[model samples]
Target: MGSDGTTAEVRCVAAVPCWVSLMAHDLDVAKAFYGPLLGWEFEPGPDRFGPYVHAVTGGEAVAGLGAASGGWGMPVAWTSYFGTESADAAADAVRERGATLAVGPLSFDAGRVAFAADPAGAVFGIWEGPLGRARRLDLLGAPVWIELRTPDPFAAALFYGEVFRWDGRDPERFEVRWEHDRVVLRAEGHSVAALAREQAGGPAGLPPHWEVSFAVEDTDAALIRAEELGGTALGPAFDSPYGRVARLQDREGGRFAVISAKP
Candidate 1:
């Protein structure tokens, strides 16, 4: 990407959220639910990690959906992948920081990837490969934001900063800031994600996890449609500085959010 983070940036820069994927118990069901909700179409993806498909929108690969393997109790959820120059080096950094490396820096047709958990046990992915397809951020049916809900936002930021080398001078480098009581990660002079403490009234005993939000034409309308598809809304849409957002779970219990600029 150029220093300004414009469309000229063809490849995903290291330390930025490059992709998001949902591992579902049944891939078809996942697709069925999201296709109508997000206006996405599916295309086959590399099968290195089981049956996988890319969720496409407007001729762009927006996200991924994969069938969970060896999974009776596996939590259906969206996982975010951060771009990296070297997955092996990033894995080592994660291990050195008292974190857990859950999966491989395994090779695939596209690139290498690994799954790791932060100190607070929030799982995320590291990818060393081409960005494959450009994402339509903040548009209809596209991912608008990624977030980490943890016990300690500062500690989470520090761990990720070291692992991703956020301070480096790479074109993909990020600027970190504390804003409105949350740690925000910005790239190309725009906010990409945030780290915040788990809210007091959130689901009790739920562990820390990275959350992804998709843009919609209407937040409440999308939320009602989610319920029709067997998904549960954590609550009604609430206003944020950016827009109105509502968290919801898929039929399989995968959590995600839908937001709209209109209130």
Candidate 2:
């Protein structure tokens, strides 16, 4: 990344990174959803890989907007891939270790990227960009968390547990937990997200999905900004035992969260 480039805050891994790609059914629709929700700025780019909208947060590319294809009969939503040192090497190592390969060791000069699923079936991405930055915080707090809602929690736990060398375990709620949750991970070497298995036949619209958490100074302010801007409030802003969160769908179908940890 050029110093003159928009990604100037390379120093604050504590703030936002560039944009995340939201996979949606329609390009403009997706943009409509996010444009105001997160208070993002979009840049025009070639329509090769997607209508390929560059969503700007804080004057830099914060997330991406793209049209979706088949990955299952799934519609619109956002998912993520981790940034790796050598995506090819990471993909090869994961595959050799029994993980299933989905995409490629192929290169993207923009970054070295690949897609794959862990033993438990949760997917993640890897990219060591030209700047070599992994996760950055913008309006979304550097993707502070990742949650996988899968049918078989234990199975998914066992798979990723071995693959990521994660300590997988279950603890009943309110028992004084140390980031206690299934599928625990360290974001930038700090504890970030956890995983949990959904009960069989759990309520509507829930499937094996990954939920990402971004940072916000005030969830209420962000929520107001989101609605006033044109994003859909998929769920009401709520407080959990964990943190304050508001779920949203950008113009298309890319859903992500803006969270603020309560002291």
In each prediction, how many residue pairs overlap at the backbone (N, C-alpha, C within less than 3 A)? Answer: 0, 29
Per-model TM values vs. the true structure? 0.89, 0.69
Top lDDT model = 1
The candidate that wins on TM-score is: 1
Assess each prediction's global lDDT (C-alpha) against the native: 0.81, 0.57
Candidate 2 has a TM-score of 0.69
When superposed on Cα atoms, how far off is each prediction in RMSD? 4.9, 6.3
| Candidate 2 lDDT tens digits, 114-201 | 6677665556665555443334433453455566667776676555444433332222211111354464544454445566666533
Runs with alpha carbons beyond 4 Å of true place in candidate 2:
1-19, 44-48, 68-74, 131-142, 151-178, 187-189, 199-204, 220-235, 250-252
Which segments of candidate 1 are over 4 A away from where they belong? Answer: 1-11, 70-72, 131-136, 170-173, 199-205
User: Distance (Å) between predicted and true CA of 115, model 2?
Assistant: 2.2
